[model samples]
Target: MADPFGMTELTEILRTSIGLDADVRFDGELAETEFAELGYDSLAMIELASQVQRRYGVRITDEAVLDQMRSPREAVDFVNSLLAGKVA
Candidate 1:
């Protein structure tokens, strides 16, 4: 399967989901910035995860996995891995 969400796309989703400033950088920040630093509470994460499932068709049903996704880059990587597994 093709990569449904590129880093840019994933970053955009995260930015929108977390209500970040449009000018905020994401490339390096995405990997380093924790979700809490971006003002994402547990409710926000649940919403984000739901949006991810809806938009990417990747089910993130595990709370542990969601807890592990501390940054946008991690979320993007996890989603890509799930997509790759489907293709394989």
Candidate 2:
């Protein structure tokens, strides 16, 4: 079976980048943001973003975007859109 989220390649990139073990389907809601609650901190976010850029071959140069990516789900959606040639 194909991974549902993996349909968007960047979602797979996010999983690899963030070491996410669980499936994440992001709808981009701020109320659902929970990365820190899930044990991701600044260091983890930075590492994840770096890996995302490297894997996706896109430069995520906006620091504000890092602050806004507050959960594994959110990060997956954001990166997925970016890779799809869309804005998150």
Candidate 3:
């Protein structure tokens, strides 16, 4: 079976999804605190989620989920759960 998650893909997704500069390092292990530390706000979360939804074809209707995401890993897990048919 394919790897449940692709690190390179995830990194690329995050880099584009968050509008990060190409030179920025996106290691795919950012924590929620790191997001806050980096100044990610409510609007940024919405935009990021929207970008992820469009790119990954995963719908994130619950805004709370985005609000609850404290890290890139959590966001990936949430999207993976939705893709696995765990949320509908």
Candidate 4:
């Protein structure tokens, strides 16, 4: 099945959640970019996760998985996997 959420939409969601400056042009393609590089700390990740849960109805309760999500692409892939029933 195709991803319910496209990468662009996910990127926008991530950008909104991260609250980047207007002038700060997020390339948004650096899928491997670490959250720390984007000035996101653990709290930010938690907030992002909460946002994802609220928006996608997918609860990501695993701390390890959360910790492993280093970029918006990773989060998006995880969410898509959940939506596809590829993850439990």
Candidate 5:
């Protein structure tokens, strides 16, 4: 199995999903920050899910990204669950 999904990877995908420049650092705490506050809406979440699927070979549904996942930390944890086959 691949290594666990993490913030660094998500950071890149998140920035790209929102069309932010790669060099743009996220202001405030990343784990605590909501995706909406960071400029990601439903569409962006779907895009993030797509990128993650392509890159991670993991299938995270748009519904999971939109409804289950919230902050970056939640995303990481949710992804890890899927990766570990422990999602409930």
Candidate 6:
């Protein structure tokens, strides 16, 4: 199995996907911070999902991206769960 999907990796992908960078460090606050509040939109979230699928070979739907993976913490947990066979 691959390494666990984590916030640091998500942060990097998100930064590139949105074409901007912020000081959203990985912390309790950041974990719960919504992408919209970070100045990122659904399209950017879609791009992040695309990058994750390309790099990890795991596909998560845009609906899932919008509904479930609203924040970096949620994304990390969701991807790790999928990678762990916890979600089919």
TM-score of each: 0.78, 0.57, 0.63, 0.72, 0.76, 0.83
| Candidate 3: tens digits of C-alpha lDDT, residues 1-88 | 5535444555676576655656655454443334566677767777767766776677776565556555666666666777688434
Clashes of 4: 0
Q: Rank the candidates by TM-score, best first.
A: 6, 1, 5, 4, 3, 2
In model 2, which runs have C-alpha deviations exceeding 4 angstroms?
1-33, 62-65, 86-88
Ranked by lDDT, the better of candidates 3 and 5 is 5
- Clash totals for all candidate models: 0, 0, 1, 0, 0, 0
Give the range of the ten consecutive residues with the poorest summed lDDT in model 2.
1-10
Q: Please write out the lDDT profile of model 5 over residues 1-88, one tens digit for every residue.
A: 5546877777788665657655755434867677788777888888888888888778987789987678787888788878778433
lDDT of each: 0.73, 0.60, 0.61, 0.68, 0.76, 0.80
Candidate that would win on lDDT: 6
lDDT of 3: 0.61
Write the residue-wise lDDT of candidate 1 on 1-88 in tens digits: 5567766776677677756677767677556688788777887777777877888787886583457666877777777878788778
lDDT of 6 by residue, 1-88 (tens): 5556787788787667666556657688978988788778888888888998888888899899898888778888888877878455
- Candidate 2 has what TM-score? 0.57
Model 2 lDDT tens row, 11-77: 4654666555576554456326676886667777777677667666766655845665676556656
Error of 5 at 72 (Å): 0.6
**Superposition error at 42 for model 5 (Å):** 0.9
Task: Note the residue pairs that clash in candidate 6.
Answer: none
**Candidate 5 segments whose C-alpha is farther than 4 A from its true place:** 1-3, 21-28, 86-88
Residues 12-69, model 4: lDDT tens digits: 6656876654654335556667778877788878877777778878778759445656
